[model samples]
Target: MGDMITTSEQQIPLAKRIRAHIELADPITWISPAMICICGALASGTATGFQWWNGAHWGLILLGALMTGPLGTGFSQSINDYYDREIDAINDPTRPIPAGLVSLNGARANWFFLGFATFLVSLIFKDAMITALAVFGIILSVLYSMPPIKFKKNYLLGPPAVGIGYVTVSWMVGHIIFAPITWQSITVAMINGGLTAGMLVLNDIKSVEGDRQHGLKSLAVAIGVQPALLVAYTIINLCEILFLVLAVMWGNYWVAAFIAFAVIAPIYSQIKLYNDASHKNFMRYLIATNPFVALIQIVSAFLVGGYFG
Candidate 1:
């Protein structure tokens, strides 16, 4: 809340500026794609391990990570930061753009370059599916961040849009690369999508004040934090419950038990989110806990594959 300048912001070297901009991309956010890779592999009904000595399969994984991380998620984060500069100025002034570490033009150029390079890389794969997914991601990133059609402004559409982009579509891209596309894969993707959307809602709680100031009606801003928290918990718990029930219906009682056990972490996260609505706390909790949550899905997929294989 205070406009105090940190020492890190004082040192304005070229490398530091570049790092600042890259940091804005938030590479740590790649858990979405990572989870997808795992789930897709499991749903593909194939063994998920690869030979580190084999360049072909390993290369595909690396390429997927590059596209999903820098080109896709990076572009989204950069453009979002650009569009949310005003809000950042209020809520997160030390961010790259708001802190004056990167020029607005420089940020725009980053988005353009990443967007093009992602598509170009996808084309190199000579796979229509990959190219389409890449394009879809780019389009979603633009629509989510750009004005007039910035879906991020609408509480109803914003979180779901991101959930679809970050979870379902991203997961499909990873899945299709190594696995046959199937109905089961899509079901997994949708479940992950719902979970991610709920997590996004909790993430938004931290920014309610800034969103309010920016006239953005995020769920937290529109319905109050307590009610928004309830909605988030509902979305998250509902998905997990469905996964558990389906696991039992499929006669995979071990998978159901695993998922039931994994549910505890999210409940703990919700309690933490309820207590500390600060952006810093939410981010810390999310980063620390989201992967574990994703792991439940990943391991559940592992069990599903084992049971059906």
Candidate 2:
């Protein structure tokens, strides 16, 4: 009985411990952020749509996009844990960093490991250009997450860098999806990046307290919560207006209408969400609108791609 009790006690805690590490990833919240990059690649210059139609090239593109996003996300997350070690000890002591499934040195080492993996796959794409961009991504990922250079702590720069960087990186993945890239492909890529950046700024609102605790001056902190959210929605709405107008002009009235409705529904939801804004409510509020904008962009891309393909 004593031996059995000891083994059971040990096993249960280890299982609980593993679950804690998984929770640190915030996987539920991170799903779209990771997949959106893949969708962006599909929308811009689908790996499957390439003329070369070779397995090896498509493998590289697919592997690169997957690594550039989630792996980079993992690195950024590790760094976030490193910087927020103290913060996590306060707000989330059960997390891996605080509970210790990952050591400080281990997190740093893992961050670099993923960062290096990102570079290796990026190098497999369009010569040194893709490789250079990959290097920039790693630098920025570390820069945003680490202390003394943690851009996520900044209001003005953080959101744009994260969002825009995500979009552009995805687009660059698309560029490598094809060889001898063209002007049209690059334009679509930028648009994808721009719209994604817009959504990210809005997301910073929900993280305000956590960011503020760590001296992270996110948009909500820089401009107060309500106004920052208002500005975020305002820009988001404006993008919707532009998208619809351009779609109509190009005779893609269907896309314009779809976007028009998609944008409106979120505005309505946000208006309702703001009225009672508790911490729980604000986190819930974040759920109502953030990913839809990127979803619309990705949807629009597929629509365009299908129309042309």
Candidate 3:
């Protein structure tokens, strides 16, 4: 009984540490990128009348899409954690690296392995577009985190870099996986990119102190949090409004309605952000609205497919 109790005790802390590493890898943030791909797939498939689901390897395609986030975005996140360890020490010591839940070398290994795996998986789909976009995504992820090219240090470029990598690249990869490229796919990618950039800006709201201390010029660090919040809101609201208008133009009332409902959460979060720019409030705003934000791409799928009508 004593031996068993000791083993169980050892496992408990190990499990918690593993959980922390995974959290640092950020699986939750992966959903948006993966869903963005699916959204593009739905839109392109609908427009091109391509039967993506009818293929023998459709399961592989789905797997590839799911892997998009874990391999691409999650890898980028780990690299960011590795590079940002010093900043995290100041702002979020509870993070895996700073807390010693995961070693710096472990994070770097994960980044390289995930990047290679992500690219390898794309080849299984045998689609040139998918491969191209996957390669582009890897490049962008490296540029975002690796030294001397860390776009994350620039307030003007950082958010947009993440947005393009997460939304635009993923979206285009999904679009061309089984369908011909179309203007609809391009437009949707652009819109999602802009909105995702806004979301990245909002993410910076919680990192202002760390960023400023680290000499990182995130928008929130460069400008005051309030103005950064305003810019984020304006960008998000504008893209959403553009999406609504485009949905109406496409006769996608369902999509428009979905977007309108989606807008409510951001509006409320903005109100909360305006009320307080503290990290706690920003975290609250994220928790209150992130799932809703993930659903936006899903709604885009429905919109393009005209599922409501």
Candidate 4:
């Protein structure tokens, strides 16, 4: 809404403005809210967790939901790029910072704005656990990006750090909204986080060449490309299957069925590329669609709601 209200004395092309805004928003990469909800649905499906729809009426987990996806993510990414400008310049010259589409100060300003927004929105959670999770998301994001503890560059630690930040905080969404925390929620979130971390490994696999040149030791760099791809695919696919099986066995197969149906095309396409290995670019080109993968997750969560009375 704020971005849409363009002011006068602005001569920049509207297309460029829109495109720049998307870049500003970081425009939903693969790790979007889809997983948050899928993870949410799986968490919510439990007898203890948040029910899809309460018998009373429809309610929303506004706080954890907000902090996990658009708001928390937008701030985290802007700050991440601000700190990693040099590395990104080499690895991603076309990005807003390197291309001069956005300045360091402007990006920093956005980081502050979004961070404050997350904090303000977090009040909606009310519960101490939910509030704490939101705070953790903020801190982990900053810690993941900042120095002296820049976990982003650590091969073993980086992926898990990022994945855990997302999956657990997101699990809280369903937990507080539907029910309290359960072993089921924790297990599902951990497994789901593992899957996301695996997808991230594929991203590093695509960027290994650039990362090595930049002196960054990513998981992909540690394992190398071929092995890394295998590892990445294995984890993501495993997570997919694990959640599906768990849901089905619990008689809430709707979530798994929806997820499988949505991902069949992307998985097939990815497998085709792997068989050839001639189009490595497809790896990067495709990894950005993670948010789309996340969207399927949201659908899966919604489907889980249906299996209930």
Top lDDT model = 3
Q: Which tens-of-lDDT digit does each residue in 1-309 have in candidate 3?
A: 011111222344777856866777789878878877777677665445435556743664576566678888888888888888888889988877777666655566778888888888888878877888889888898888878879999978888998899998887777677677677668778888998899889888777888998888898888888898899888887888888898889887777887788777657667877887766778778787677666776776666554556
The global C-alpha lDDT for each of the candidates, from Candidate 1 onward, is: 0.76, 0.62, 0.77, 0.65
**Residue 172's C-alpha lDDT in candidate 2?**
61
- Model 1 ranges with Cα > 4 A deviation: 1-12, 47-55, 265-291, 303-309
Per-residue lDDT of model 1, residues 200-285, tens digit only: 98888877889998888899899899899889888887888888887888788877787787676556656776787776667766
Name the candidate, 1 or 4, with the larger lDDT value: 1
For model 2, the superposed segments whose C-alpha errors exceed 4 Å read 1-30, 44-58, 180-185, 303-309
**Candidate 2 at 259: error in angstroms?**
0.5
The global Cα lDDT (0 to 1) of model 4 is 0.65
Please list the residue runs of candidate 4 whose C-alpha ends up more than 4 Å from where it truly belongs after superposition. Answer: 1-22, 38-42, 45-59, 62-64, 244-272, 275-309
TM-score of each: 0.87, 0.80, 0.86, 0.76
RMSD of 3: 5.7
Task: Give the Å shift of residue 227 in candidate 1.
Answer: 0.3
By lDDT: ranked, best first: 3, 1, 4, 2
Candidate 4 lDDT over residue span 1-309, tens digit each? 022112331354667744754576574742454347435745465465555456431335544555667677777777787777777767778876666666555566778888888787767656777667667877888988888687887878788877887665676565566666666667666776787788787777656667787667887687667677778777777777776787687677666676566456466666655665444546543764465456545544544444343
Cα RMSDs of all predictions? 4.2, 5.8, 5.7, 6.0
Q: Which ten residues in a row have the lowest lDDT in candidate 1?
A: 1-10
